[model samples]
Target: MNITLAQAEKAIATAKEKAKAIDAKMNITVVDAGANLVAFGRMDGAWLGSLDISIKKAKTARYFDMNTGIVGELSQPGGSLYNIEHSNGGLITFPGGVPIKNTKGEIIGAIGVSGSSVDNDHTVAEAGSKAI
Candidate 1:
């Protein structure tokens, strides 16, 4: 199932809170199960460049139904998914992307955060995903 607009908004709000807690200005993107943009937020002073990265991260997570960091892991040199980022237009095969699952444990969408360190990005994304 896809994420509802309400759920998407909640995700963004939670992500923003986490970003603020970490003193990070972030570009956050949430995409539905079909990998369509559902919501987005760019905190003041956030990097313009990171906007696209956030969107790609969300899509990458939904496209694979897994955290983008996991994809990054397998895409390392000599790994099974090496060079996989080159496919599907382009992918941010790094931290900051996470799948959003419903109470039923079914993936509904994904959240992506950028404009900070990967660890902070992932943390924010995790916070957002858990909102639902």
Candidate 2:
């Protein structure tokens, strides 16, 4: 099953609303289950550096089928799956990434956001996921 553009648009819209509410510019990325890009958006004043990081976070979520924050924990110094992150093109491991699960509880995609604090990023991504 493929993720529809409409779903991606909904997620982006939700993210934009949340980011605006917090007065923070943001870079947002959405990826399919295979980690392919679905959609992207950057607020007017978002940092350029966040573009790549946001995409990487979504890819990381798709690759692991889990949130990037959990991936970070697993890839940490003493964690069991530490070295796997290095093999997947070195995706960013952080909390800004979240899986988009279908009603069946299957992950259909993921969302990622950057250009703000980690907490804000997570908030935006969560809002996007709920919108979808």
Candidate 3:
């Protein structure tokens, strides 16, 4: 199932809260199960460059139905997924991407956050995903 606009807004709201809690200005993005953009939020003072990065991160997560960090690990030198990022028109294989799952544990969408450290980005994205 795809993520509805309401759900996407909820995710963005939650991600914004987490970003504020950590004193991070973030660009948050959400995508449906089909890897289509659903909603986005850019906090005041957030890095302009991170806007695209956030969107790519969410799309990347939905594309693989897994965290981008995991993708990053597998894409390391000599790893099985090495060079995978080069495919898909470029992907952010680092942190800040998380799949959004429903109560039935079905992945419905994904959330991605940027403009902070990788750890913080992941944390915020995780918070957003859980909101769904």
Candidate 4:
């Protein structure tokens, strides 16, 4: 499965809308199945530091085909994947990343959001994922 430009745009838009709803300024990113960037947006007043984190969050989700939070939980100290984040040039193991799936249940891409609380970011990313 692949993500077209329109789909990427839609995801970003939805993520931004959700962020606004939560009174957050966020950086959002979309990546295709191949873990390549497809689209990205930074809301005005978002943290500059979160730009790379947003992109990495999307890549982390696409690369593992799972939400970043689950990965974080799994990879915690003494967990099954302890220190796994240190691999693949590091990963954003916290919340705010989700896979984009097609009707056939195939992951077509992923969305990531940053510049907010992890819970809020996860919600925004979910909004974007659902839009796709």
lDDT of 1 at 46: 100
User: Which model, 2 or 4, shows the larger lDDT?
Assistant: 4
lDDT of 2 by residue, 11-125 (tens): 9999999999999999999988778999999999899999999999998888878778887888788898776667767788878999898777888899999998988999999
Q: Quick one: ranking by lDDT, best first? A: 1, 3, 4, 2
Candidate 4 C-alpha lDDT tens digits along 47-70 = 999999999899999999999999
Report how far off residue 19 is in candidate 2 (Å): 0.7
lDDT of each: 0.95, 0.88, 0.94, 0.93
TM-score of each: 0.98, 0.93, 0.98, 0.97
Clashes of 1: 0
TM-score of 4: 0.97
Lowest summed-lDDT stretch of 10 residues in model 1?
80-89
What is the Å distance of residue 35 in model 3 from its true position? Answer: 0.1
Estimate, for each residue in 52-129, the C-alpha lDDT of model 3 and write its tens digit.
Answer: 999999999999999999999999999999889887788998999999999899999999899999999999999999
